[model samples]
Target: MTTTTETATHPLEILFQLQDLLLIARKKSEQKDRIPEHLQHVDAAFREISARRAERQERLKAAEARKKALEGEIADVAEKTKKYQGQLPSVKTNREYGALLNEIDGVKREVRAREDEILALEEQIATLKAEQAEVDATFPEEEARFEEQMAGWREEQAILAVDAERAAKRAAELRAGVDKKMLANFDRIAKARGGIAVVKVMMMASHTAACAGCNLRLRPQLLSDVRLSKEMVHCEGCRRILYWDHRADL
Candidate 1:
């Protein structure tokens, strides 16, 4: 009778090798998470400045419209004053001439008020233009800074890409050496638990154990199987595959 010898490799050794690859992959993912955070302030500032520029543009248009209206009112007042002066000579009585002169005075006052309004509108328009100029000068500098930051992010991403490729290749080699079902289960658990599927549990004593991932106490039976390395053992608390490191217990 012919019999085959079963493989004697320990599951913990396989997981230890897998953890090294996972740490590299996790580092790349975490570095990617920081890219957007670094640019958040610049992005928010751009949006706020853009809104201020739009509001100023609208105010400028309103000021120009007010100036034009004031000019039209002044012109109308001038025509009315001219007509009142022509009527002055035609007045028949002293009272009539006095009333005509008072009317002309009122028209002159109206003309002055309109001209003052036009001057105020012109000042407002100038201030708005200056603010717009300031924004225009400042926005480009921020834009250039944003571009520089983006370039730095791209450089880091390029480096991460190479590291990720190496990690993935190592992970593949490790996966092939592990039991197919264990790998599948590990992959599933990692997907559900954010890239952490296997964990080392410290046996506090022969009967007491603590899961490293969740810090939950491990059941005696579960700890025993993990120590024996006889079969796969999963933590009841975190549901992560558990392995005991003898050095940690020592």
Candidate 2:
């Protein structure tokens, strides 16, 4: 670690400042993490409603297509019946007349079946249209609510942005007083370990020092060096920089 030429500030004090910087950084990051989570529900609802609307529209289209097909079939059957009626005058034998009449009756029955199917499809189309109208009527309200929710999220994000900027500025100021080499070590350690670079050495019941970061017992010589605060002291278990509180007994 880089040694500080400044005699006024102790190593422990410098590490404490760095620790405060880390806390500020972590708090700002945590606040940013919550912003996206806050909008998750609103976003999910919007997508789900949109999917349902699309499905309804698709169903409506299918029903309309079925009605058109049935209508076409009914028209063709009607034309065939008219042709069969025209053929009745040309039939010379009683058997031919009877066959023509039977064919016309079968065509009429088919036409009726197709007409009934068309009516059913029309009814289905009307129901779908009504449902679509209801969905459309509520759409504007849902859109407005979604917009308002997004606006609220933006407002919260703006406020959190200001807080994050303030915290970052304070952390930068704290970093300026810290030794360059020590800060670099802390930065490296923090990147590897969840933003924690420094920890206290607590006096354990066994008259030994334990690392607060990992709760592992520290060696006597390592604890002694940490107490002196003359150089960087790292915990053997977690490798975090260790410090000693002057008020704490060993």
Which regions of candidate 2 fall more than 4 Å away from where they truly are? 1-9, 35-39, 47-141, 150-155, 247-250
Give per-residue CA lDDT, model 1, range 65-99, as digits (tens).
88888888888888999999999889999999999
Clashes of each: 0, 0
What is candidate 2's TM-score against the reference? 0.54
Q: Write the per-residue lDDT of candidate 2 for residues 103-199, one digit (tens) a residue.
A: 9999999988888888888888899899999999999899889888889777876777778777677778878877899889988988788878888
Top candidate by lDDT: 2
User: What value does the lDDT take at residue 189 in candidate 1?
Assistant: 83
lDDT of each: 0.81, 0.83
* Candidate 1 Cα deviation (angstroms), residue 215: 2.9
